[model samples]
Target: MHLPFWLTTALLFPVLLYQGKRARKHTPRLPEAQGSPCGQYGEGTPDIRFLVLGESTAAGVGASRHEQGLASQLALQLRERTGQTIAWHTFGVNGIRMGQLNQILASMELPQADVVLLSMGVNDTTGFTPRHRFRRQLLALREMLAPRYPGPICLLSVPPMHLFTALPSPLRQIMGWRARQLNRVYEQLARHAPGDFQYRSYPAITDVSLLASDGYHPSDKGYRAIAEVLACEDWFPDQPAP
Candidate 1:
């Protein structure tokens, strides 16, 4: 049976606070961002501008090269699916929070895009963003990206943190709860968002081997796997599956 929120938080607080230090100690020094020169490939008529925004996953921390990262994998697959050129760009830092992202976008010239894909939330969970604030920032993000793409804005679900091999005991449990709670908010938006905000349900990644040595971020193989799965999803009504 689930304990009351107050009781649960009180019980877990001290242990979780210590585990946070442990998590940092165990994590490997992250690789450089693999988003620059962003995956601009695939040649055909009618170029489709694809934008990937948000967090380290979008910036591709674990993967060694951008080509092996999610952005490139998705870009290649999109090219195959559409039989059109795809120019994909990824913009994000390793530890960005939602509010930071919101501020960043507000100051920049939002690029035009036919399709916009996103990866966020895990950091938000770790960064201590409240659920309601997360929802608000997420909605604000969508509002900003919606008009740029004006076609489909797909938000990938928060990963299942409870299962991560990297996190210790109560930390995993606590983070998992946070991830699940945030996921519920995302799902609600997918169902109710006025326009084409889709909560793309990314497959659950449980295999530790596919993850980076840090045991947190996706490895090259993991990024490729995720990208392949995303490419297969019918992002458009009549678009054929890969």
Candidate 2:
């Protein structure tokens, strides 16, 4: 319900509709990364439990296996930086939106984690979810996870779609605009929540080489770059690396 999004959609509804169909028809459907969704890194009993939950990117669509995916790469990076055992788990569903995640979480018997990473926004952006609804679902998700996790809940900012090589011109432009708007909402929510919520801006992927074959999701190298940046964040200033 951001004003810009409404205005853009109103002006470009037809072009957006046509381009959306064309993009879907041309884009290849890549499978999620293979292998177990949960694993541990480094030595010693896991002192840090990390969980990644969200859409295709969280599910590791572009990578060949879980090891090469975002969650795994992040776990490896954290293990290296902290020199402590890190346990990581991911639950990613292709093309799923934030509201749908609530149902999934309610159904599953999840594990306790020390830190949570949420990868979302792409699908919501594409689906044209109203800003108010997106914010509500996000707050609800945080409420559901906070009591169980008892740690920081970091939400990764939605990628800038205008930079995506796969999407056609106007479509990419509109998507990017929407993405920026949604990210603004994320920043506001995080600002208000203080210790309860955190938002991390994504490193822009401008190079085509950083994208996967479909030109949408991140390639292994892209995931690695993202993980490196995230793992280095001062999320655990109080619990310094030992």
Candidate 3:
């Protein structure tokens, strides 16, 4: 999955510049995470506290309704799947990178979460972060939250950059390559982290219609698709959501 040195520097340079210019003028800004900051769903005792953390995708940019977003969808699905009332909270910003997330989590007070679902990587690629730095920041984020949310953390693969219709040409391929690299780092981290971490691969997106109008983020249908995959992961299928 590694790109050659020449391709990294020479081939991608000019394209990167062109893409940046196009993005500034053409990329549409989507709405932020909506709905109540914290929501309760289903019925059970000892409620399960769930946290949704990460960048735009986790923030629910493309989805028109808060209920259509990942946090709410996951909360509702978990109730249906396991019958536990979920105290769901979403902490996501549209354009934050991994390093910023690490810094933010380090300073903030997070809910005592039973399960933490994260969606990032896209912003890391957008920020042109080196692979090692991205990995370090990601792990740092997990470590920062470990003490407060001592439960399983599901780290989603960066959505497929190759599929972004908004981004043109070689830039798409380059971003796609970088996105894969980021996912590899996440996968490697999860392998060693075991019970504390689980790497969730980006689900295969079949319908282009599922993408938001911006074509960079997930549409409401897209978020539902993501929530479905997260809810059905074998790791948490029948267990207490934590």
Using TM-score as the measure, the top candidate is 2
lDDT value for candidate 1? 0.78
lDDT of each: 0.78, 0.87, 0.77
lDDT of 3 by residue, 46-153 (tens): 366778899887678988767788888878877777776776788888899888888887878877677788888887886678888887777777677777777657
| Model 1 lowest lDDT segment of ten | 32-41
Which predicted model would earn the best lDDT?
A: 2
Model 2, residue 128: C-alpha shift (Å): 0.8
Residues 202-225 of candidate 1 have per-residue lDDT tens digits of 787788778887888899989888
- Rank all candidate structures by their TM-score, best first, as comma-separated numbers: 2, 1, 3
Which stretches of model 2 miss by more than 4 angstroms? Answer: 238-242
Each model's TM-score, in the order given?
0.91, 0.95, 0.90
Ten contiguous residues with the weakest lDDT in model 2: 233-242
Q: Considering lDDT, where higher is better, how would the candidates rank from best to worst?
A: 2, 1, 3
Candidate 1 local lDDT, residue 120: 86
Count backbone clashes in candidate 2: 1
The digit string of per-residue lDDT tens for model 2 on 1-242 reads 46766887889999999999999999999999999999999767888888899999889999889888998999999888877788999989999999998889977888768888899999999998888999999888888887687665788999988888799989999999989888888899889986767898768987777788998888999899889988778766655653
